[model samples]
Every structure is written in structure tokens, then in C-alpha cells.
Target: MVFSKQVESPITTEFFIDEPTRAKIEYQNGKALMARGPQALHEHVVFHMEKALGRALPQMEVRFKDVSISADITVKDEMNLML
Candidate 1:
């Protein structure tokens, strides 16, 4: 899973990963957490990424959070671009 946010100033990127297919995100805490499932790893990764964004840029635009799979996830394939 992947997530992103557009911020002002010099643009940049960040990364994160949750352990044991689980993670806690400070932003949108409930929205992503609720997505838990068999593909928990994917969800956790996205959650981790979202939290990393805050660490990378405290003033970042967090509303842009996105999620997708590294492999071809037929279900969310269309959302890859959003990631």
C-alpha cells in the first residue's frame, strides 16, 4: 500500500513500514485503520507512509493520503495513479 500528501515549499517524499502487518497512523487514524484485512501488510504500509509524511513535513498537506499494492492488485489497480 502507498499514501501521499502535497505540501508547499520544496517538494519531497518519505517512506515507512509497519511490523507484523500492522501499523498506527497519527493522521486519518481511523480511516486507514479500518481497512484491515487479509492484506494487512498493504494497509500497514500505507499507514506507516501516512505517519512518515507528518514526520517528513509537519506542515504537509495530509489530506492527499493514498493506498495501493506493489504487485498488481486487480481491485485497487485503478487507484495506483492516485498513489
Candidate 2:
């Protein structure tokens, strides 16, 4: 599900400054669109991906879901080289 709205202000700075904690908002062509949360299938896939990565690379850290503000999955080592 995607929810979109038009705002009077520029979406760059102001959108993030007042963005809701749970909101995944995107800006496109002056429109503010809220992204839908992951579905069950997507979550399951991510979970398995995380597990597989962890097993494959025992020395690295495998993170899934909200690893960063814009990242869904991340693999990081002690040096943080592959981020």
C-alpha cells in the first residue's frame, strides 16, 4: 500500500525534520509518499537471507531490516568495509 500527499513546502529538509518515527516517506516530483511496511513474504525472505549470510560469513555481522535509515539489509565487518 502506498499513501501519498501534496505538501505546500519543499519535501527535502522539512519532510525529514518533522517525519514521524514510523513513517517511511519518500519524495518524488514534489509529492510526499508513505511507503508500506514489508509484507510477510518479504519479511520471511529477509529473515532467511540474514540467516544464510550469517552462516556463510561467520566473521561478519549480518543485519536485516532497518539496519540504517535507508538500508534494509547490511553486512558489516570489523572494518565496516562492505557496508
Candidate 3:
């Protein structure tokens, strides 16, 4: 969840995520504010990589049977975010 008081009333936004979400939230002088959702950042990274490479990159996923697990693992070569 995120909160902002830049308006007359406080604004709240909620998100459901499967991965650890990255956020940039700032409050200036306890009034003005700024924030970005993790989804937005993910799209930005995907867009830039696609544009720079001139092609869409392949994506992968894996699953396990009879067991449940949650972990931060590396998918691609991006060291910034681990799945």
C-alpha cells in the first residue's frame, strides 16, 4: 500500500504482487509527494531493453509439483532485481 497527502485528502493505493516490489516514494515538506508503482518500473525496464536490443526478449517460468515455495531467484542477467 502507498499513501500520499499531496491532495486535500490522503490518497491510498494498494497492490498485489508475486515478487518483491520496488518503490520510490517521496514527501516534500510533508505536503507534496511523488511515487511510482512496481509495475510501472517493470514496464519501463522492459521497454528500454526491447528498444535497445531491437527485439523482444524471451521469458521463462517454472513450477514444481507437490511442493510450495517462494524465493528470490535470478531469471535473466539483470542483477538489479531477483525473482
Candidate 4:
């Protein structure tokens, strides 16, 4: 199993801005956690999940790892209601 790594040293917003990474970085409660790139298995799972969700809930939109801020997956209605 894989888990996100917590940054050891305290970091400022400036440091986070200076650092560049393709992986996602999440900051919360004075701590920073970096997410690893999705593995092949993980991608496969997410793809299938999205497909199934799209079929089952045709009226809703399904997104995976596309939110600008902090969301692994999001399913929202046409009116953009967060569920």
C-alpha cells in the first residue's frame, strides 16, 4: 500500500509556491502532505469507477483528481450542487 508523505520541516506558503511538483500537495493545520503519482492500478480503478458512476448517475458529473483545491473525486448535479 502507498500513503502520502508528510513534510518533515515546517514550510511557509512561499516555500510551497517555490517548490514545483506534478504530484498534489495538501496543506492543513500547519502541516503539508505530498501525494504520490497515481499508479497504473489506481488509474485503472478510477477510470472504471468513473465510467460506472457516469452510467448509474447520468444526470450528475463525475470528476477524478481534477478539482483545483482538495478533492480526490467529485460527483455533482447539473446545478453544481456538491453532494
Best by lDDT: 1
Candidate 3 lDDT at 46 equals 55
In candidate 1, stretches whose alpha carbon ends up further than 4 angstroms from where it belongs are: 1-38, 55-83
> Candidate 4 — which pairs collide?
none
What lDDT does the true structure give each of the candidates? 0.48, 0.39, 0.47, 0.39
C-alpha lDDT of candidate 2 relative to the true structure: 0.39
TM-score of 3: 0.39
- Residue 54 displacement in candidate 4 (angstroms): 0.6
**Which residue segments of model 4 deviate by more than 4 Å?**
1-38, 55-83
- Residue pairs that clash (backbone atoms under 3 angstroms), model 1: none
List candidate 3 segments past 4 Å from native: 1-34, 69-83
Candidate 3 on 5-70: residue-level lDDT in tens?
121212333232322343433446323232365555554465557569976556545657899779
> Over the stretch 1-83, how does candidate 1's per-residue lDDT look in tens digits?
54344333445544343243335433465565455543554545545665777553244445454765487555656657673
Shift in Å, residue 44, candidate 1: 0.7
Cα-based RMSD of the predictions, in order?
A: 16.0, 20.0, 18.3, 20.2
Candidate 2, residues 1-83, lDDT tens digits: the string is 33222223332311112223334534473233323444533333433464577632122335588565565787777896754
**Model 4 steric clash total:** 0
Please tell me which model should have the higher lDDT, number 1 or number 3.
1
